[model samples]
Target: MPSTVFDIPTWVNPKVAPDRHVQIAKALYSVPGDLIGQRLSARVDAQTVKLYFRGELIKVHPRIAAGRRQTDPADLPSELTAYAMRDLNTLQRRAESHGTHIGIYTAAVLEHPLPWTKMRQVYRLLGLVRRHGADIVDDACRRSLDAEVVDVGVIDRMLARGATGQQLTLLPPPAPSRFVRSATDFAVRRPS
Candidate 1:
């Protein structure tokens, strides 16, 4: 009998997870952000893993050990690269570039026991800056920080309702009417 080559790569069809990664041999490999929730074919061999989408090669990564992750920052959304890499400073700097208060506000928003969990909120805040302008977002962030609120949704609501903070000045109380007695008038007078 003659010796013959019999090496073949194992093929796997995996669905890209919400995090834009696929598992091969227990190791996680990142895919493009647009591929999330889509099925992809992977060719796994001894040295590398190749991913294909719709029969077209999309990504290739060196095979890693089990319980490890191989992520390419370019494979993730630009806004999410910092989060995926747990680079909190990047987000803070991005926010600060818009405004000092915006940076402080984002830091407050991301100040959690598990800060990565709040990355999406920071992402939303930055998006708000783009949509509503940096000055507007910075104003909202300043107001929110003054109010001790750290919610992106609240800032978004402020922008949606055109809360420029200038129009929120307190108005003087209306003059008392004879018909409406003051609360003190209803109180029983105790004998001295």
Candidate 2:
């Protein structure tokens, strides 16, 4: 028999959300990235919440009121911290690091009443820079911006089709085909 019996605490089995957080008592707490999608054991007390994975303690967070979230930056991927935090300045600076046009394009796309709503587009544009290369994406952004078009899909299509401004600038028009007809061939004469 134990020297003293412990008080029964409230427990919940919560699956980790994609954002690397689990909810307890309507409040959210961060969890290690590796634990995402896995159900965790959470013990709720008066002042703190304790989380367990397979009976091993994994995280601890102070109890917050319902409708609030407590995030420890360490739990998020380094590259995603700015995104999760909705820090537009950080995102814009990252775009600027790629090129002047990319930064301008990012700013254009994010110029919304609710700027945070466009964060995914800016993030996807950054991925395009990684996939196609900064020079190519920068040129595409320049062309799109010049045309007053602020669509990321258009920029991605331009990159996919290799139709960047520099490439277009260096290429000349194709020569007319030998099978082309002369203007006289289609000329109509009055019946005489």
Candidate 3:
């Protein structure tokens, strides 16, 4: 697949002098996980190297602009030039470490949705149960099982009882019928 070029935004300022080694280090660190099976987009200009990991902006090395103000292709820094080759080497190592020899394009095809989305929602509800159902388990036992176990049945039963109680409390009170308007009518009222 053809490589795509990303235009680096002019306003972004780099805090440190960009060294190729440091830039590579920042890039590796900025990535969320072990870079074994991921795709990276690296752009090197006169002043900086910006990396995008899995389509997300990850790191920027500002040292690329240390001596140059103009973005002349001919005046690209030697460090950046060396970094381009070095970055490729690192990418190769990452690929091999992950047991794959494919380039970034091929890796993109293999990426899957993050698992945390499902895990987080389940974790939140489980947390609620743990906080509210403290009486159900001993403190020592709760601590041991907190990270490993989920009590689905207890949560369901608690929720069911709460719903039933609410339904009963919300019921309308009984009202007297118009036909039986007064107690005197039922009592012996003189014929009128």
Candidate 4:
């Protein structure tokens, strides 16, 4: 009997449970994204594999050596990463294109030190434009800015309550101090 040779495919995208990420060998990889399932294809190279989504290359990883596990941070959405990796200027410009108040609020978000830290909030605000229309988001943003408070949570609540056009109340100014404390007040004194 003639011996038959079997060719084995080296690359694999093992199925994962719902709300879980795909596993490639010991490494976990992202399909289009973790939130939605999408068709993905992987091409094996001598030392790496390229992952594609909708014909667009999305991730690449080096072949896993025995007993080695590799994790690519880029595999996940930027928001899912440890810190939001985004361009503050770009996000601000996009918000500005919507409305002045939105622009101002966006500016505040970016101006805060380490803008990446606040990227999720900025992205949420941007997404609202598609959900509620620019007019409504702009109005909400305007109200938030005028209230002298910029917060996505507050804006989301207002939008949910159909208060986009409602006027926002300004916070009361800080109360006047009745007395000024001097540093000597805390000074230790020897017993008489």
Selected candidate, larger lDDT, 1 vs 2: 2
Give candidate 2 misplaced runs (Cα > 4 Å).
Answer: 1-8, 54-57, 163-192
The window of 10 residues in a row where model 3 has the poorest summed lDDT is 101-110
Tell me how far the alpha carbon of residue 143 in candidate 3 is from the true structure, in angstroms, after superposition.
Answer: 20
Best candidate, TM-score: 2
Q: How do these models rank on TM-score, best leading?
A: 2, 1, 4, 3
Tens digits of per-residue lDDT for model 2 on 1-192?
889766567999999998899989999999976777899999998788999999999889999999999999888898888988888999999999999999999999989999999998998999999999999899999999999999999988888778434454556878877899878889999998
| Per-model lDDT | 0.90, 0.91, 0.40, 0.69
For model 1, give the 10-residue run with minimal summed lDDT: 161-170
Stronger candidate by TM-score (1 vs 4): 1
lDDT of 3: 0.40
The TM-score obtained by model 3 is 0.21
- Misplaced by over 4 Å in model 3 are 1-117, 133-192
lDDT (Cα, tens digit) per residue for candidate 4, span 1-192: 549554344654445424335556555544445635554666764567677665777777676654554555565565544432355666777789998888888888777767788888988988887788888988888888878887898888888778446666789987756696667888999999
RMSD of each: 6.3, 7.9, 18.8, 9.4
Residues 51-101 of candidate 1: C-alpha lDDT, one tens digit per residue: 999999999999999999999999999877877798989988999999999
Error of 4 at 21 (Å): 7.4
64 Cα displacement, candidate 1 (Å): 4.8
Candidate 4, residue 164: CA error in Å?
8.7
**Model 2: how far residue 135 lies from native, Å:** 0.8
